[model samples]
Target: MFKLCRLKYYLRNKERLIILQPLTSSLDEAFQRYSSSAADKDFLHRSILPTDHFQASLPRLPIPELEDTLKKYLECQRQILTDDEYDQTVDIVNKFKVTEGLDLQKRLIAKDKRNKHTSYIAKPWFDMYLKSRLPIVLNNNPFMYFRDDPRPEYQNQLLRSTNMIVSSLKFMKTLRANILEPDIYHLNPAKSDNMRFRKIMRMIPTPFVFYGAYMFKTLPLDMSQHKNMFNSTRIPRPGKDELVVNKEGRHLLVMRNGNFYVFDVLDASGNILEPGVIMASLHQIMQDQSPPNTEPVAVFTAEDRDVWASYREKLISLGNEETLKLIDSSIFALCFEDNKPTDPNAITRMFLHGEAGRIWFDKSLSLIMSAGGNTCVNFEHSWGDGVAVLRYFNEVFEDSTKKSVVHPSTSVQTDAASVQRLEFKLDQEMKENLQQSVKKFNSTIQSLDVHHLEYYKYTKSYVKKSGMSPDSLMQLAIQLAYYRQCKQTVATYESCSTAAFKHGRTETIRSATAETKRACTLFVDNHPAVSVEELKKAMMACSKKHGSLTRNAAMGKGFDRHLFGLKILAEEEDGRLPEMFTDSNYQKINHIILSTSTVSSPAILIGGFAPVTPNGYGVGYSTEDSRIGFNVTSYPPSTNAPNFIECVTKALDDMYEVLEGRHPAKSI
Candidate 1:
């Protein structure tokens, strides 16, 4: 959600194509890397109850000290600023520390004290997302692709959709019944992840349950956002939007050719219908003879939030109150795409920001499938961070594939009485509004381009053997890639989850640092004096600093959230911006050039999002056992996605050569 909250993009008229910059990557290599750990998930959930039983005992997110935060903030700013600029920023920070900063810090602490059940950053973070009026299309929503089913028959579009729906509903049932395993990171799986440990945990009360796991070196993440994954929608209001959850609703929403269809996935007793019944209903919908909608109502969700909110009120006033409610409260949405895309890159674009009218972006989870069985989940951002979403994503893929909920052939009933088609009462004015929405959405999507580049020369297995942190190494590669493209250091953002604490969101792992600047200059600026040994030394320093930053962010001791809290408190309580907060360097530090995130998992094939700035690049990368991949995005003419990807591959090659003790260049 913080990815594009305060962003504004400038567009160009160039035609766009989703390009896959092919390197030495293959499906076999992908399989060898991801197939290592499916058993790890099942091992951790031997026996458990109440997925959220540990919530009451989870630790609260801590507030970093004011001076500590200012110091760390300057460390990040120093790399991006000149000496003169750095001195000015330091002076401004000092003044704030003695003045508005102290009061704001006190007020924030008191507020956190008053709200012990949640984190200090929770409310301000929510407010930041809610107050920003950017349309959630490219600005906020992000997509994660699932690896195609291994069996050819299961990849059939109808079969894939039916199986995924059944798997997702099963997941919801497990979660609602408190049987789903809690999200936990175990340091020693052998000791903390077995049935013995789980049995001990179940013996404790809810308030003290986490301590049982903590004793065995286990940590449970806050699961507050998981509930929003079902029966929820983000309602656009005039000033601020609302995230509403209605657990009472029990139906599946289907969007095809811009028409809305609903069917009861649950019985009167609230138990899920059998998989055969779901397959029959989906098959019936696919055979429907209705023509494509001339004016799709889903396009209204793509409009600017205030405009959409205004029209939403107009929609309700037109005697469609019950209709809108039913749509919002459905379990989740499943979208059927009309196009069959052969190029994997095109599939990424289709899933990321597909045809606007065919997408209902307000729904928390929308499972989209093409006619050829390419599928992904396009998720709304405000309700949760990736930790919550990824848990659902990974489990759904595993359950559907491993359990085989439905076979290739299932008997269909002519009348699945629960299926209902949703009809909107649209006037001529609303119909005209739909045409304008299409124009606006088209203009917005045209400016962005996406590319995926995979580097198979080496991956995490080699990095681990070389005694380097894989995440830290990849972050440096990204920094090096940007410097090679731009010839300078700039602000960078790496996502780190703080979900170990109560109601935690995310903390910025400020990736750009002084050591990274020295390393990039040595490698990319072609400095002749830098030896291979010296370059390796510099790389180690960069990785070490990055690892420290990641740890600090995960521990909730990072400066980003602490500084954000102070800024928020100042605005909320004093109603004025501090001089320090108004500094130009402060603004520059938050511009977030090279916004990169590492998305490595067994279930996800690729993940991506739009850049946070008009010219900046959004980089989603994965470092696996034997390969690395980058899904690069940018608004072209201002920036180039294809060229940026080329630089990334070059950076990875150079870094790997350095790791191999090769003299890559005379300069380095």
Candidate 2:
């Protein structure tokens, strides 16, 4: 039964191709090397089949029709394959198959762990809801609607990209609570028997569950005090000691008794809290107090703004500590709406309209300078990715404005008439299926480490040989790979990458989503398949292609990766990015390059949105060889298509033609 099921999965969904070449000495070496490489990795090991004794498998369908066919198959099988079956197919092909190399395995494993941790606490109904609703949302492509009005004047107006993100997060939060009704549990790590049993069970199929209770250690308020903490991990830990002083004037520690843990000030309640809940609650608090209003309740005229900058600088130059402190606190006050303006230089007012209203200012420049000015914006958390936080921020702003302030009496009447909901029970089969899905997810993760080191080295070397920037090379390779697999002739395959810009003035916040996250994706066109030699020559030409550098140029640099990772660590420590960049009283620091590389992978890398990463929390991946990698610092997500793989394969078939520099007619 298992073999039959596996066969059906491969025949229906897998992308199989035959490589026919003249028998040569190098051919044997190539096959041996490739086979050995595949054998060492989990994904490739499953998908690859040695046919020394038989003819190679025939190409089942043209490349271009492949993606569409797969999509159709998935859609049609939606009813037949429960989440478990779908997951099983994914596992068998991605993990058990012999095609995914070692690097692919590592990526898959990382994703699997993440997904499992997330699922452990996730409601099955919620996962189902996401599966059902997400496809609808993607198919509708509501985001494309924002692109329709690209006028500069409307850039910051109406529902912008950030606004969409915020709306989505808010909706998800509400849906999770109202519809999913997730059970609250904690991991009790102190009990060795329980912990061991739980770990073992995690390897087996199980329903969505999280560690019921756990307590991890905490960091001190001073960086000097926590030298021992740095020993726990090689990657930089956020300088939590410094961060605590900036936000809450104390050190915060992560307490974990088992899997359940909490990050809080020492001696505080140690209940495990949901990161999503914290984000939603924080957003609600900010939005409710400061509803979206067109009129700037706080503004500065051109002259007053100049004078303020001058005065602040003078005080700082003269080492006037008291005045500097006052200025710093005042800026925070402006950002947080904690104080009223005294001796107002420019007229700043707050305005509120009915739901679906706009926040506008009569003063053109002043309004433009504020958040809703020339650029649309959204906040992000230090720990979270920019995209996710921006989504939450936008949602809060939109939801806050949409709420109509009804009289207390009306509210009471509505509540009194509301009906209590009943809990629906899942049958035994349904429960078993949910458990199996989770197990399959774990199995995929286990396979990721099969060839981690080798795959990483090969990929790194391949990127270098391509002679394109890291982002661009990755994008090109992905495109080529996808083209080979799908064999489609689309007009263009768009690739995009994002850079982060920070202009908001909050030093320390509970989450990274507190600061604004903005980014853009760049697109390029790919030429159709040609012989190997020709394609290589073209690739060389493409790599040499260059244009004047813009801010986008800075983002394309590999340095951005380090900076992005640093930002998260910093935020996690200090509750936000570096304060030096956000000191409104001195000079409002804005814009930092997060991820600069081009979107070069065939697979899409959706980043800028933060992942929910609590200690030990994990996410799952659908494909063994195909996994999404996020550069958290980038503004918008980027994608690389699988066209390059196809190009490489085609090159192998017509090496002599390519060597002669014969160009093929445009087919894709």
Q: Rate the local accuracy (lDDT) of all candidates.
A: 0.83, 0.24
lDDT of 1 by residue, 71-133 (tens): 999988989998999999999999999988998888999999999989989988987877778
lDDT of 2 at 135: 12
TM-score to true structure, per model: 0.91, 0.21
Query: Candidate 2, which ten residues in sequence have the lowest lDDT sum?
Result: 512-521
Off by over 4 Å in 1: 1-47, 665-668
lDDT of 2 at 645: 24
RMSD of 2: 27.3
lDDT of 1: 0.83
| Residue 623 in candidate 2, Cα distance off native in Å | 21
